[model samples]
Target: MHNFEEATSAFAKASDAISLKVNFPRTKHSAMGLKPYLTKTVWVLSVISLLTDIASEMLYPVMPLYLKSIGFSVVLIGILEGVAEAVAGLSKGYFGKFSDHSGRRAPFIRLGYSLSALSKPMMAMMVYPLWIFFARTIDRLGKGIRTGARDALLSDEATHATKGRVFGFHRSMDTAGAAIGPLLALWYLYAHPGAYRPLFLLAFIPGVLAILLSLSLKDRQPKPSGKRQLPALFSFLHYWKDSPPAYRKLLTGLLLFTLCNSSDVFLLLKVKQAGLTDTAMIGIYIFYNLVYALAAYPLGILADRLGVRKVFTGGLLIFAVVYAGMTVDGGGAWYGLLFFLYGLYAAATEGISKAWISNITDKADTATAIGTYTGFQSICTMLASSLAGWIWYRQGANTVFAVTTAGVMGVWIYFLVVLIPEQQKSPGQGG
Candidate 1:
């Protein structure tokens, strides 16, 4: 019995040592600085996003104008945006769970991007608002399919220590594409007036490239353990019940914060409200993208060092201040500042939130947790947008801003009392 016990202990130690050797230096430690930046998986996925967003954003910035030109009412536009976003959010959780169950990520990603690519030319050919609605819905569906799967793949490939950097780099690349997409659209619009169709068709080229790039991605299947074999479609409410109270508290705080975050359309509307021309509004959006692209990675690195919860809380506070400023200031330059600050907020929270959720959940359920978090946030965003729209139509812009300000204050109080203590107890819970 002693001999058997000794042998078992020896084998366990040997297995651990082997794993350490194989996975050690998981992130390269090259002298070239940038060479050690991200795992090959993250780089490939980032490139895919870069191409995909370039295609998607080509139409996105001017989508409202396109809808208006086609005679869609503002109410319809709001409904379309809200529904599309809600669908995307809702799908992420289910599709993510599906991927987890099937033990495949790459195929889902391919399907998603392919669907999005197909939507581009269809959008160009739309003769009616309904066609635009279908195109946008399909496009957002594609986004939903890939978002969780791709993030799960990123998590699978990156070392825990470098997860923040990998996610941040991916976001930076994604936002860079966003910045470039609008510029390309602007150039196309300039060179050929009333050639939106041609630009939309042109966007399909990058979408094809994104799909092709996705083909090269390798799927990382989770191990076939007993824990993983259980029913995959678990309720997030039940899942949270077993989680540390800190995680639940953090999520509650996040829900509060997002309720005020609302949609970017409101920001564009605010720009117009501040007296910017349509063209200048697009230009301001371009400016926002540029700032978002530049700041995403650095802010991610900062989050890694200073902690995600702190960075996220600070981001919420910044957003409150920006909304307050937008309320009081009507100058065109103030619009620019608002957009720029909004970009900063995006840089701070987008990737960091995903990283935080991953930290809170088990590895097997990472995708599910991501989906749940996003879904919760999206539901809040939908409600906020609805309220904002009502405020705009009835009370006015001041009411909208005031309501947003109140929402942010609610977020502040929730986090200070609940999330902060939870985070303190689990210092390194989420990466």
Candidate 2:
């Protein structure tokens, strides 16, 4: 086996060549423009994510069902998910900052993938649901650490003009894995009949594959600058003060947008309210993921071609409309349409937003910028999810949907008025 240093250097040289070839001027883009973006690095990272998501999702859908089978209460399961997500969200920023301070993205990527990969066999060893809880938290902790740093590396590798398209393609690949995972689980259960432990053990293969692939990723280091290092990681005060104006503005817009949005569980609850069978609900959920996977690259291309601003604005508007549609007793067909639209909204926002962030920040701070933005968005989204749940319980679904729609609409207008113009003037697109 090659030494790690040699493997890293080889990966970096190959990535650099691919980036240059594919990320040529958007004006010179061809019908085969995607050929360039089909870089070895991006594809490798996407495959890693694809494998990781497959491993995670195979277990994810079955987790609650498995817990209930093992006599764990719904309350405990809910607590586990809540706590795990909170830990992941809180840790993202710190890890991103670490990647920046250390000037290496690959090490953090390796460590994160290793933690999550270790989580699989741990789940297989579970005799109690509590053990599963620890396993799940460990997996989520890996997600928190790797996500920002991974995106930063992606941003670094992508050209400024094609950032949206590149991120969009990655999202497409990730969603493809999400779509495949459940089917694999379902097939496994059908073939082996109640062999949950075997299925859990099988998850380890993909997780390990993900980790091994991640080990070969190139780490981009910050150029030699003699800026004073912070005395302590917790002493982020100076860093925050020194953040670019563009990053701050972008963060404000993101916080406002995310504050209006909440967890997808609320959408699922609406499906339940509509009296859909559990099987039908699963079908719809899978269909939604498929739509998300299929639409991401095309929409990302549209973002690159027409401007991410235009596409993002349309997405926000659609979000408001979808939530508003849910406020009423729309038939099952309408609900299906809303879910499809939700997928489109995801395609519109997820990658484009990251590309947008890359556009606004200095390239050196890519990891820190992505981490801070993601960490802030995760915290606010947590609050938004809780608030939506509370309002739905206290009032009604309509009341909850109405409030969310109003908030989304408000943000849409705010974006049109303040953010979009800046984006048009910014480097991501034309003046």
Candidate 3:
């Protein structure tokens, strides 16, 4: 009961912290600059993402180091990440389809965030490989549950014209938390010097706050359809056939790109292998996210005005350059530039792809379409990470990166020649 009381108090405080007048006043002079493109729901959801990402990213930069400290090899780490991502990928489809089928979004959001919140503390409680995997899977399971529904909520909140700005603003806010979380971890690690366990518990604070904030969101539930069959585990796969040809074409390029774009952990590991300290590694990560946070919204606006296809493909080009740069023998100096470009790559592609997908799909199937795409994307990411890890183990990091750079170039050409032309002719080019 005392613990319950403490949680209630925490919720009240978090609610107050997020109140419009206090934090993001609705006035013209508001900190975030109130705009018609961003609605209350969008703001609320962004804050939830911001808080949740803080919790997740706090652990992210250190995860590889922590695993190594516990005697995990690079290959083992790769397998673990691959498996965890696979679980999240598969479930993203199922839950996304389930959310669409149920005509409700808020319940899934609430449950998902809560599970993620609980998983934060779970990581600090035990050191066993199975226990760690279980905790990590819970964290990713929460992500799978909410991503499609949450993104659909964002999609519903904006028109095709405004999708870029809305999603961009949300990404900006979310990445801001990503920046802040790592900084906090960096500070904690500086003072404590390798005391990683306590940081996991610290992450739980923001996660709980995210859950509390998410509670305020109310889904516009559609009236029930009469049929009552449950969605199949891989039912979201069916959307591939039902989706527009443009969506399928775009997704083909995207999935191919993902097949080479391995986990970011490999990047951090690269820095570590170069003899950089933990502080230096986290510092580089912090810089990358800061660049991403700063660039995401402005780039989103650009995508809206110029064209999402232009912006997304341009980002891919940057991605190729960054990967190519990664093949160089430069020290911290070159890494900073590469990560800056990488950040730009992330800002351009991540939200813009979703906005593009949402624009092309029927409104009713928004969740299913995105769920299926991301679900497949995640599976591809798993394979990519595993493959990169194996290559790093046998051949070398340079070979892994070189292969990725070549893949990105091919994907970029595919997007420009194949996907873009098809999108232009498609009926859904409204964005």
Candidate 4:
């Protein structure tokens, strides 16, 4: 018995030594000196996202179809989409703040990913439309929890000079997953007609894989004392109150722009209205994601060379043009062009906008600023989506497009006349 106990002790010590070796933090020099393509943390997280997005997009492209199949109305679809987005936005801010307070990102990340993974399989069991709604909400809840923590981890891992490149690369990988996901769903749909449950079950596999990959990530060390404390839940009120007039004006301009930018479901509906079949719509969407994935990194590089605001404004202008084109009588080809340009607009602004926000804020409060910005934008989107639905129901799709175009034009005028001059004088001018 004594010999057996000794053997068990020896095995425990051996296991401890192996864990220590495997979990040792990489040297700062090693992390810093990594090749752009071979950065360990970035690559690991990218793979995590790649797998998770594959799961996410599988459901994303088919969600509306499922709703329609179950006899949901357009208004109901808009509400669901808006609620999902709002929940995600609100949760992004809250979970980001929670992560900052905890001084640990990994646990939240693991929990979030695990929750999302579980939610996907549960989608298969959803019978009623309300059950599906609950499933979607749970899925979005996981997204909200993961997004902020993952982004904060990315920022912590990157050097300032290469932040654009790092984030751009990550975004590209994410969109590439999006590009593949829809195609995968299309194939599955074709293979087994009306078998969305099997697809949902298949989604669980990738999500689980992503969570397993996340377990390998090393958490950031806690920041030293003398840093600013995290603010309270209502901190945004104080932040806006204390911010400079220029900052206030910029936020206002952003809000004005977002108020017009409704849910992308409207665009999908437009494709349907324009006489394309469901399979054709998915094919067009796949093309749009291809454009988005291909263009995002190049646009980020351009933002680094030119300026984020300039690239962002150009995107807004493109949006204005696209909306105007949508207002005009157009065929299926025009809808395709509109979707492609929409992808371009997304590539121009998505990561760059966050980068710009990071540049403007204090380093200690980086997560807070990002959360606040996202929260504000989400509120605007919620309003815009609801209004778009109403406008489409009452006035017409053309009128909704016309109104959105006008809002985009207004943003352009504001940026040109007001924000540009103030931006030039700011400490971190240009990209």
lDDT of each: 0.75, 0.77, 0.83, 0.74
The TM-score of candidate 1 is 0.83
Give residue 285's lDDT in candidate 3 (0 to 100). Answer: 87
Error of 3 at 25 (Å): 27
Worst 10-residue stretch by lDDT in candidate 4?
422-431
If scored against the real structure, what TM-score would every candidate get? 0.83, 0.86, 0.86, 0.82
lDDT by residue for model 3 (1-431), tens: 45654553454234324421233222232234323556678878999999999988888877888888887788888678777888889988898899888888888889889999999899889989889889989988999999888988898877666687678888988999999988788778879988988889999999999999998988866658697788988888888887778888888999999998998988988888888887788789899999999788778767766689999999999999988888887889989899999999999999999998888877677788788889999888878887998999999999999999999999999987884431234455333
lDDT of 1 by residue, 166-222 (tens): 677789899999989988988888888776677779999999998888888877664
Per-candidate clash tally: 1, 1, 0, 0
TM-score of 2: 0.86
Among these predicted structures, which one has the highest lDDT?
A: 3
Better of 1 and 4 by lDDT: 1
Error of 1 at 35 (Å): 10
By TM-score rank, best first, the candidates go 2, 3, 1, 4
lDDT of 4 by residue, 1-431 (tens): 45654553454235334423445443343356443422567778878888888898988877767778777888888677678787888777777777766677788788888888888888778567688678878887888777767777776655444455456667878888998888888888889878777888999999989989989877767543565565476555455776556556777888888898998878878878888898778778888888888777667655654567788889999899889988776777888898899888988877776666555554444565566667778888888988998999999999999999998998888888885331324454322
Which ranges of candidate 4 are over 4 A from the true structure?
Answer: 1-38, 65-82, 126-133, 223-237, 242-247, 420-431
Candidate 3: misplaced stretches above 4 Å?
1-35, 64-79, 127-129, 223-227, 419-431
Query: Which should have the higher TM-score, number 1 or number 4?
Result: 1
**To one decimal, what is the Cα RMSD in angstroms of model 1 from the true structure?**
9.1
